[model samples]
Target: MTALPRRGFLTLAGALALGVTGCQLSDPRITGGPTAPPPRPTPTPVPDIPGLEAALRHESDLAALGKQALAAADRLQLGAGQRAALGWMSRDHGVHLTALLAPHPAERPTSPPTPGPRFTPRPEPTSSATLAAAARDGAIRDLTGRLDAALVDYRASARGSRGQMALLWGSLAAYARAAQVALVRDAPRPDPLVVPVRELEPWSDAEAEQQVLRQMHALVYGYQAAIPWFRRPESQTAYDLLVHWRDLRDRVTRLLRDRGQTAPAAEAAYALPVQPTDRNTAAELLWRMEAAFIPFAGAWLAAATEDESRRMAAEALEEAARLCLEWGGPMTTWPGWPG
Candidate 1:
């Protein structure tokens, strides 16, 4: 077919007729109020994972028991270290179960689909960071009894590999017992600088900023139980690498006090803030810590032979610091803003 000239092929301009237009009567149905009644609830898909649920339940129960023990110790004013240990144990186990169960497909259906970003306020300076604190405390109150019992039993024992291991475990456990008492009487709080603003709730605007400080104190001190293990194996580099972790911990604790002094709350509260500028700093610090841990951990692992598992413990300690620094630090400034 012959093609039309360029001018002749010009497109037609569409026009709306305003003055003269044909109209037809229309019928419309109007609905009132809201929509239909809510539908029946769906059968929750409880994941039948082998032992997962049981473990979660068991840990939860243990944590509850630990909390009770902690409370009892507080009432009796005894075994502070045991109470603290119990508190730590409780919080750790609870956190562990929370993480394990958080990913189950069955769990997803029961909980509402997370529509948008869910913010968690950094923990606040409270009576204790964990139920393990209580357990630790309880253990301490009865330490005299425990130590007396251990000493009585130890005099009759002979030395062996198992004995050495038991001795080490016993010494460490005793140290932990001592620590629980100290922590309970004078619990170290978290730093305020690191506390997120979201943690403060039901507080007036003027007092909310103080919540941030309270949260920092609670969080930094929360890592107290685990952080010191890195230095015990006699490694300066390991300790140096942990400087960031230690600094962050100290910083949070300091911040909490500073902020609290500036803004005191009627009661202790935590608030994780979502400030873009602050988040950026937190993200950068986390990245730095992660980058440092890889090399530090390698150094510890390379020297793992012939020595007591001190090297292994050092490696583990480094890993723990790294993880807390990475996941527990400001998470808002990530791949993208959370919904």
Candidate 2:
């Protein structure tokens, strides 16, 4: 091969060097093509709302106390009935704990905070009546106080949260209220005239009316089942409940009409979960019926469009829950979100 002139050789060398530099610059890793971007510093998770943490901690503390109370009852060698009652109360606390610990989008730390020290139940009383009454009273007082505080936290959290979280907090507040009634074997007649404001999510008028209609249908069925047992003198409470149910049904019917929707017709009959042979059995059946109404009423309350309608629904819910307590239903942590 003939050697090129110096000028031409220099030009050729420069071109080769430029081409090599271009090739080096095009390496895939240098340009982040087909290579993962530098692992973005893993973002720190946002902390949970202050109210949420407080509620969880409270629930954990209650659960620990419940466990201690149940153990004390067992050690006291209480009667089967008494022990069973205590067990019911303890179970409510367990349920509260489960709800508090359940996975939430806002959850952080992956676990609940450590609960405070376990409560030590008072020693068994000398008198059986004293044990029954005092133990129940003490348990009720403790649960009701804690539950009320939890309600405050939940309500505050609900106000701060959006969408489903708000709904969850409101429902939990209602559950706490129902549990309070259940703890009191003799719940004083809730002020029949005092109506409460129901916390509702934003919904269309049609949606709200539909929910109200559904609740009315539930109350109608409950009334039908309970009215038959009103023959007994002891069924006065049941009679009162029937009248209240009718009032609620009428109110909902009017609400539907106002919204230009038709109220749903009640079924001709509903199958009773248990046959009633006596007044006590009848009360129990009614209690079950009323308990069933709570969630439906709560749904209505949650969806109600007008404040008046929401207030009525809330009152109806409280009435049904109170009646259930009168008839011997166990206190539960989630009355409106029944399994």
Candidate 3:
């Protein structure tokens, strides 16, 4: 994959100023000059996260690339659906860049503002195949690699951060993973699939609900297998996984009952996608389980009619994405898409 060139852009900040003046009383009768107002408390400064600035720049570059890709797609006259999807993904990148660039309360202004360069837009491709080739060979590969780097940066930032910033950076990393998946799905692949495409098609509402139940049951079994590995005192990741999987199981159970269906009983044992010999392997296997659940979650999202059901499915999709990252799975572009 070709390396993305660094493009510099200006970092801007907004400032607020306050002015106060004391006035002398004209009358001697006034007991004393107006008492000075109590001093305003100063806000505690937020600490800087190392490499966060570089990560933000990288994300901004990604967003610029997305814009260029969208422009190329338009010039190439891609299908409306493809165009729309690309547009949405590009816009998402823009939003992420804005969030990353927004001034934090703890950020101090630079004396001499630094101006960054803009991305140079490439000429439009003449054919759809050319476009796909560019995406497959260039943009998608670059994005996946950069997303991995950005995830590392965000994880580091989260460690040094407190309160909402910590949560925000962590969530941003997950979003980057999802964006990587979207780019991969949009790109063309050379190989034929072993699994038939028809099998990946979206199911009817009833079918989707059933699939969700099956997935929930499988996850319950998978987590049960994983719990022993996570039972070590130092295994916070394992504990988190246990809690998440169990909560998902219960949520799915409630969903099933709400639909007037009985949730399937957990199996005595579930077949592992890959047999685990150690903690690392167990974590990998659990990650695969979550990856497998994504499609079902997507299907449920599509088939759900009620707002609550849809929200639940959305939450499931996001959680699965986050867990996949936690377990070192490659970023997926479309976790909720049936395809």
Candidate 4:
């Protein structure tokens, strides 16, 4: 099989379809991406095997919860969107479970089955009376809470995980967290994913972590460029975000240092995937910049076993999804993953 590019990210094509421009990984808009590393080599799979067994059990429990809730969906008085979310989480967990059932990627599912609809923005009922009246509302909320639980354990296990298993844990954690955000309140539900779930060859952990740092650099620059285009309130928001990302850039730089890797110097100007001609494009750039890093950030989460590193990666994953929506990006079932 062909090698995954340093930034193919599986969902790049789908993000472009949403009217956001796809990135050219080679573009060095800022701290130009490190010279292309050779094709991603076959990764050595050595994640925590015992943790894998534990994860498998936890995943089974999650799947059972989703299935039980979904089985009672019609009686739950859930709206179309709510029912869709219930189904989405159920489906996603099952998908994750099925993959885990296979001990190795060689036995992984080849065909991407139906994974239900991702959470979309559904105007939550404004009145408290209606919410309280719903008989099974608590159950639904509990099911969503399990997504959070999944994320927490996934990150914890990642510390002891290695290679492909670690990568799977990171990706599953992201999916659970994003789904919970959607079900709790409607986030922008993205369209069906266009990215194929191909074989599970993952990026080298260190490489994935470094790439996130570089992307953070590019985002800091993008956020700065976007600041001037918004009105006072939005302009301040953008400015604030610029500062946030700048700080995060430095944070990740320090993180890399702690990991025994020296970060590259920042570039003068990073490549702009979609230059902002007006307010809309500027906002578009901001969200896309945030959304772009999520895929590999999962890989970074997998590789980063240290508490600080794992926390950063997990927060980055969740924050990027929320920030994407904050900056006018669509909320999809898969929040961080573009597809």
Candidate 5:
């Protein structure tokens, strides 16, 4: 299936990211042209997220300690198979945590609500929050077991289906754990289905394409997470980074095509049918919208005084941050923009 046109995809993504709206924001200057460039790195801006620096330090410490435990386990000369299993298990935990720490930025809106459809509301907060709140440090450790189980199942799956399936299960498991962490961390927990209007159902081809787009998005998110954070933002540096990211997505998509997958469709409607001036304005418009959406969700997540909201926010941010980081990488799968 062909990928959804870029602007439409972004529209959906923006809606998800903002947890609101459906209007398209294509600019007139887009020429639908493709350019080839090398992958460059963006100077990492200090995050505007509240307490982000401290959180990073805390995350770093935990990761270091986790690695140490895994190393020690290996030094004990545990049975090779057991050691291998544990190693994978440990890696899974790290991945899960990273995923939690940084999440996907693009969002898939839920199907629109049917006319007068029945909706079941979630129950009030439980005592678990109190317990978890008291044991914040240990909460993540406890959640690891869920991921471990999912990871084992994922690893044991048949090879052909494993990658995609592993991705799905792993994503859900990781998000769940992250949510648990958020609850303990006191982040907001707005209802997952809070969008005012119902989702619009698309064709089956659109769904298939959506999956591909998400996969491509995942590659970008991974890159963002793996790269060292940059702090400088000179034009030469910015352009170089943009070129690098642009090329990285094209390269990855090509690899996927060689493996028999089709690259995602470009945002056709957003692109100009012919050359026009002011392309930079068009690009900036989309980026600004995307930038705005991320923080909108963050605001929503940060607002809840209830335990559930806090937990949900923590979980959502983990994935959102991870995904953003991945996109920031040099190997992201989206061709046009650096971010």
Candidate 6:
């Protein structure tokens, strides 16, 4: 290299400094890459079931009925608490309708069902009629009927659906079942089953079955540990729950054997988040164990294939949610899919 003059040397140094400082060291963008905003992601298409539109319509109608009942409750001066009780259906049914309409939002009716212009209440002469029994054109009865009908639609929709759709309908059915139980304490409870028709993730039916079986075993064990620690009534409740879980475990075991899958052996004891030192602690432990089923049952519902199995799973999920309340868990909008 030849020696350069002072001006040339200064210019060359300046050029080098510019090259070093002015250029970005960042990774170069690909020829047609992230420079332009990524094409707006196309939303994944939701699955459409055969009877889903009907389910959506039913939810709309159910929501309307709930609104009317709420209005009637307000008209009768049923108090803030009673008004709140009547309001859940109005809110919950909106969620039900949205889930049903997810596959094709356009199918939503232009004019959704509406509560009529005015509310009418027929208070009994005895002044003893509970809000539940009030006859506003048998509005309470109609509300009950709508919930029952929605359950029917949810079940039918689950049958026609697969994967996530099945799970969605099954969850809705379970929640409806819970609402029915809440309304009428004598509503039929869920029983064990051979299997059901769907699951959200594409897992083996046997795999899901085994999971619930193992969890049920642990729950039964947990209930047994807690029963002795609870107070009189709660102790009885705990005992009853233990019995149910024990029986469910046996049923699950038999099902697994019938399917030729090796049933998992229960541990001598389970490690739990809560320890049963006293009544409150025991109850808390038991509550958590039961609450675990809400989500677990939803996962199982995703894989259930037969109608009976689906019903069993759905009801199990609902039962778990109800039990959580009994065990002093706070109210949650969505139990299985908890926030």
What are the Cα lDDT values of the candidates?
0.32, 0.52, 0.54, 0.60, 0.32, 0.58
Candidate RMSDs in Å, in order, are 24.9, 22.8, 19.2, 16.1, 23.3, 19.9
Q: Kindly list the per-residue Cα lDDT of model 3 for residues 147-244, writing each as its tens digit.
A: 67777776566455543343345445556665555455443221111221112344555566667777777776776677666546526667676677
Write candidate 6's Cα lDDT for 1-339 as tens digits. 221111010100000111223547795856855666757666555554577556656666766666666767745444443355456646666655543444442222222222232211211122212235365435546556767887787777766665555666766776676554344332222221112122134457778777777778778877888888878887887888888878777877887798799888787877775777998788777666775656666667767776666666666776776776566543333444422
Per-residue CA lDDT of candidate 4, range 180-230, in tens? Answer: 655555443444344544443355556666787777777787888888888
Candidate 3, position 251, lDDT: 77
TM, every model: 0.26, 0.59, 0.45, 0.62, 0.28, 0.62
Off by over 4 Å in 4: 1-9, 12-48, 51-84, 105-140, 198-206, 225-241, 255-262, 270-284, 302-311, 325-339
Candidate 2 deviant stretches above 4 angstroms: 1-50, 74-82, 85-136, 151-163, 186-215, 224-234, 267-271, 330-333
Report how far off residue 115 is in candidate 3 (Å). Answer: 35
Per-model tally of clashing residue pairs? 65, 0, 8, 14, 39, 14
Better of 1 and 2 by TM-score: 2
* Model 6 vs. true fold: TM: 0.62
Question: What's the lDDT of the predicted structure labeled candidate 6?
Answer: 0.58
Model 5 lDDT-worst window of ten: 329-338
Please give the TM-score that candidate 1 achieves against the real structure.
Answer: 0.26
lDDT of 2 by residue, 1-339 (tens): 222111000100000111222356656754536665566565444455446556656656555554555566645444444445445545544444444454442221122323323212212212211223236556557657776887788767755554445445655666566656554544332211112223333555556556555545655565556656667565565667667777777877787777688777665555565566666666666666666666555555555555576556556655665666667654433444323
Candidate 6: count of backbone clashes, pairs at least 3 residues apart or interchain? 14
True-structure lDDT of candidate 5: 0.32
Q: What TM-score number comes out for model 5?
A: 0.28
Ranking by TM-score: 4, 6, 2, 3, 5, 1
The order of the candidates by lDDT, greatest first, is 4, 6, 3, 2, 1, 5
What RMSD value applies to candidate 4?
16.1
Better of 3 and 6 by lDDT: 6
lDDT measured at residue 261 in model 6 versus the true structure, 0 to 100: 91
